[model samples]
Target: MVANDYQYILENMQKELETQAEKVGELTKERDNAGKKIGALEAQLSETKVVLDELELIGDDATIYKLLGPVLVKQERELALATIKNRKSHMETELKRCSQTVNDVSKKIAKEQDNLRDLHMKSQHVKQALMGAPQQ
Candidate 1:
């Protein structure tokens, strides 16, 4: 009866370990995706800042062309500047959101890892007990 109970516990622990491992994999993927998104956004933000600086150097009467879908429409310099600024702001906000998501997912992964380690240790001890060996 004692051996049976230990076997049952070991099986259940193995199943739980598998589930937690799967969850960790998912959370790790999510964190990686979020990091990639942040990198892309940062690159875009850098490019936009350069454009904004160029716009600042342009003469007040300089004509700007805004790409609208498949067409390039003529726009005033100020209007183009405002549009770029808005896009930069939006990208900044998105970057912040992505960073936060990465942080949250990282924390979850860490906690799950700790749980998995504890489960693994318990499973090992149970296995030893079932085999009638001293558990170290």
Candidate 2:
């Protein structure tokens, strides 16, 4: 009966550890994907800023052409500047949101790791004690 109980305890702990490990793996993947998104957004934001700077250098009356599906449509410089500004603003907001998600997931992963470590230690001790016990 005692051996059976110990076996049950170990099995439960093993299952719990597996579940925690899987969660950590998932969180790690999420963090990595968010990081990639952040990188892409930063690159795009940099490109847009460069265009915005160039647009600002142009005079108000200067003609701007917006490429739409291989066709260059004539656009006013002011309108072009406005569109770029809006895009930059939206990208900045999205970047912040992704950063926050990364931060939150990182914290959760840390906590889960600590829990897993503690559980592993406890399970090891339990196994050792069971081994030292006299067999029926």
TM-scores for every predicted model: 0.90, 0.94
Q: Give the lDDT of residue 126 in candidate 2.
A: 79
Residue 133, model 1: Cα distance from true site in angstroms: 7.0
- Model 2 TM-score is 0.94
Model 1 misplacement above 4 A: 2-6, 133-136
In model 2, how large is the Cα lDDT of residue 98?
Answer: 100
TM-score of 1: 0.90
> For residues 13-88, what per-residue lDDT tens digits would candidate 2 score against the true structure?
8998899889889999999999999999999999999999999998987889999999999998878988999999
Worst 10 residues of 2 by lDDT: 1-10
Error of 2 at 97 (Å): 0.8
Cα lDDT, all candidates: 0.90, 0.93
Tens-place lDDT per residue, model 1, 57-130, is 99998888878899999999988899999999999999999999999999999999998899889888877767
* Top TM-score hit: 2
